[model samples]
Target: MYVAVKGGETAIARSWDLLAAARRGDESVPELTLAQIRQQMRLAVARVMQEGSLYDEELAALALKQAAGDSMEAIFLLRAFRTTLPRFASSLPLDTAAMRVRRRVSGTFKDVPGGQILGPTADYTQRLLDFSLAEPSVPAQPARAAAPLPDALPCVLEVLDREGLIEADLPPAGDPDPVDLTREPLMFPAGRPARLQNLARGDEGWLLGLAYSTQRGYAESHPFAGEIRMGEVSVFVCPEELGFEIDIGEITLTECQMINQFGGSKRAPPQFTRGYGLSFGEAERKAMAMALVDRSLRAEELGEAAHAPAQQAEFALCHSDNVEASGFVQHLKLPHYVDFQAELSLIRALRAQNPQEPTHD
Candidate 1:
């Protein structure tokens, strides 16, 4: 009789040690510092912080290094670490109007009041391989005075309201208490608009691929990024007892507004609708994709065809979490002997019962 497997504990411990060593790399080489990861791999850190739903740049940088530049894995690592963090006072809703923007652009208008700041972007960078900088040297940069911050532009809607173009004249109500998704299981018809807040804080590569698939006619492709803004948004928390808002902190965010022109259906008049995307860092592509996906998800609301995969709220929202998707996909590597054995036994029994079954055919 075969004995049950034993002494697996020691093997498991050894395997863990090996994994740790591999992650750390050689002892002779200088250890990868968090600062190095933060400065050099800024995009990775930004992604981690965005998807991880935490705004700590330093921690995000460390997670990126630990995950070896795997944005999804780094997000998971950061999120897992975030769970252990102490619960501080929840901040109030951020006022995007008060956002001290580093960069802001509007596709709708070429020239706005404050003018445009292109900032750092790879939009025009050629994909050619650069072999010149084998050894990097810092060049002295010119010092310049800090640019003056622009005052918030009155909401574009306000302009329409003044001209009697809009039916409503009320100022935009600030986002009320936002809900946290990590603490709860995603329920059916999930309404956490705050939870879907990632268009601001999501992984750029992942979002870009999803957006590309749509453009390739895999999903709804008709979309235009109305505006993409990157800047700081202030967070405030007002306790019930305090009865007043208190400033918490500021976080860098990328916000995208997508416009989809919809024709009037039998039921409603044609109107310009909005889809919003927001994230924690310079994630314009992600935010734009998110806005498109968001509008696509509003097929029901817009009284449009809801047959497309992008139009399915359940599928899109449920599968959107990169951590959940990555975990389930990767978990297949774990031992599955018991399930495999069951399938094998069933197959053998079926085969034995049908001896004349055409094996070759």
Candidate 2:
């Protein structure tokens, strides 16, 4: 017998209570502390911050624990938390050239102005599982200071500019302030700057998969990670009230400069072009992928064929936001019996209107 259901509110409350209990887990055992998550689950924290657009490690750790290590879910949590945070000011765009770098590397050249500092990274380590890490070990060595900075720090672009190898910067001013994508809805046929901003906050896994498709010959573009840098860049804001620029707190950032090899065009001779990428926190892979996608989106500007999905800025940027994507995707599971019934009725009507011919053996 089909019976009308009751206690929906009570059931939902009970379910939530069960979920809370599950998330907490084993009251007898010591609860996993936020510090432990921050220190141990550092990568997860980074991913959350990168996608969430909130760079707080502690909050990210909490979100990671609360989301049970689902990077996307954690990002959603962090983003929700961030939305409630009241904003006081906007920092001026950081000049990466003046960044107090902790780590820097260049694929295009052997030695850069600031010698490559291979900071805290797991890049070279063997992927073998260390079972011994089940028991914690103490470190033996203490910290030490390094050498001084050079008078000049040369970006890879500077080298090309020196030789006059690349075309001149496009007009309309290079230093124009970018629109805040978070506050506004994404419009169709987005500009390169807006497209890049969207990709920076994009879901890492989504963008990475899209980037992989390109590598496998889906709208391919030969890309080189010209440079990747991780460092603390001081933020400044010139408030009208103050009349002078104020130095705010610094942020850890990863910047990727990509060199996309583009050949002959009617406007200019064959020359290399720049694909810029920058992201919050230490996210090398995300930054590099962002750069490649950023360059791909500029196909129209470069007079190249826009055949790839990555090249479509509207598609890429509009779907990049996890908040938007998650809400839309999960909304399908919500109560929509009325809509379903309507759809079913329409389908039944369509079938009634046109009868299919029966096939004979």
Q: Which candidate number would show the highest TM-score if scored against the true structure?
A: 2
Pairs clashing in candidate 1? 92-236, 92-237, 199-278, 200-278, 200-279, 200-280, 201-279, 201-280
Q: What is the per-residue lDDT of model 2 for residues 123-199, given as tens digits with 9 covering 90 to 100?
A: 88999999989876887585544766443355666777678676554447566777787787677777666787789
- Clash count for candidate 1 is 8
Give the C-alpha miss distance for residue 185 in model 2, angstroms. 0.9
Local accuracy of candidate 1 as per-residue lDDT tens digits, 63-170: 877776777778888888888999867775567767787777777656666666676778768977777656666776955427766656434333433654333423
lDDT of 1 at 31: 88
Collision pairs in model 2: none
Per-model clash counts, in order, read 8, 0
- Identify the leading candidate in terms of lDDT: 2
Q: How does candidate 2 fare on TM-score? A: 0.87
